[model samples]
Target: MSKYDIALERIDAAHKDDPTTITINTTTLPYELHYAQQMTLYLERLDPNASELLRLAIRAQHLRRWEIPRSSYPATKIGYHSWRGALQREQAALVEKICVESGYTEAEAARIGALVRKADLRKGDPDTQTLEDVACLVFLDDQFDKFEKDLGDEDKIVDILRKTWGKMSEAGRSEALKIKLSERGECVGTEGFGWLSVK
Candidate 1:
């Protein structure tokens, strides 16, 4: 197999260790593995010509995420940000190691690491921005319903969604409009993004 295939296999093997399980239709998968798949799926839809490095970065976006549970941190907003930042760094380092072990040069591994960490997102790095877009798309497509139900506060959910909306590029937002949302999800999206007119 190719180096890309080797690295991807290694990444998925690591993802398989996640204890959290999610059943989609008749197939069951580790939550992180499923999330990684979703990230790749959205990345392909968003950028079909995405580079190999970008593909590897997207595949390992949440590499071994369960290692750091949210409860390990405080419950406040600062805590939430801290937890997320920690996850990004941890995943980036882990993926970088995998890249190197699978025969990638240090520079290539570092580029994958940067994409995993979403470095330079605010500075308008195209690949980093696309990674962010795929993440938002995955959340909206796969996790939004469950998340909304758990939160159970319409106003708060809309507030959170507005923040999510602000993160996406125009292309991401446009693709988001195509996702099949539940009634509640649609309502929340409409409220959060007044321009979202997804029929």
Candidate 2:
């Protein structure tokens, strides 16, 4: 098989071993595996011309996330940021190792790792922006309603939407507006993020 295929196979194998499972559309899948699949789908929709490295990075964005539970860090915002930073580094390292083992060069592996690590986000790097867009789109498409319900606070939900909206590019925001949120989610979303007008 090709290096890219081999790397994806290894990543899928690891995700398949996740002890947790979720049912989607009458099929049960490992949670991380399902999440990875969603990320890839969103990335494809966001940028069909994305580089192979970006594709691989998106697929492995949350590699073995359950291994690092959020409870491991403090419950403060600072702790949340710290936990995310650490996860990015850990996921990048794991993906790089897989890339190298699949016959990719160190430089190629490093590029993939950098994408997974979200390097140069504030600098407006195209690949990083694409990744961020995909992430936000995935959240909006699949997780927004559940997230809003779980939070149960309009202000907090709006705050979250504002932050998510800020991270998205225009293309991403356009796609997000197409998502069909629940009635309440749509109402809160429209109120919280003025850019969206849900019908």
Cα lDDT computed for each candidate against the true fold: 0.91, 0.89
Tell me how far the alpha carbon of residue 150 in candidate 1 is from the true structure, in angstroms, after superposition: 0.4
Off by over 4 Å in 2: none
- What would the per-residue lDDT of candidate 2 be over residues 32-88, giving only the tens digit for each residue? 899899999988788898888899999998898888889999999999999999998
Q: How far in Å is the alpha carbon of 138 misplaced in model 2?
A: 0.4
Writing each residue's lDDT as its tens digit, candidate 1 over 46-141 gives 999999999999999989988999999999999999999999999999999999999999999999999998888989999999999999999988
TM-score of each: 0.96, 0.96
Error of 2 at 174 (Å): 1.2
- In model 2, what lDDT does residue 178 have? 85
Q: Give the TM-score of candidate 2.
A: 0.96
Worst 10 residues of 2 by lDDT: 190-199
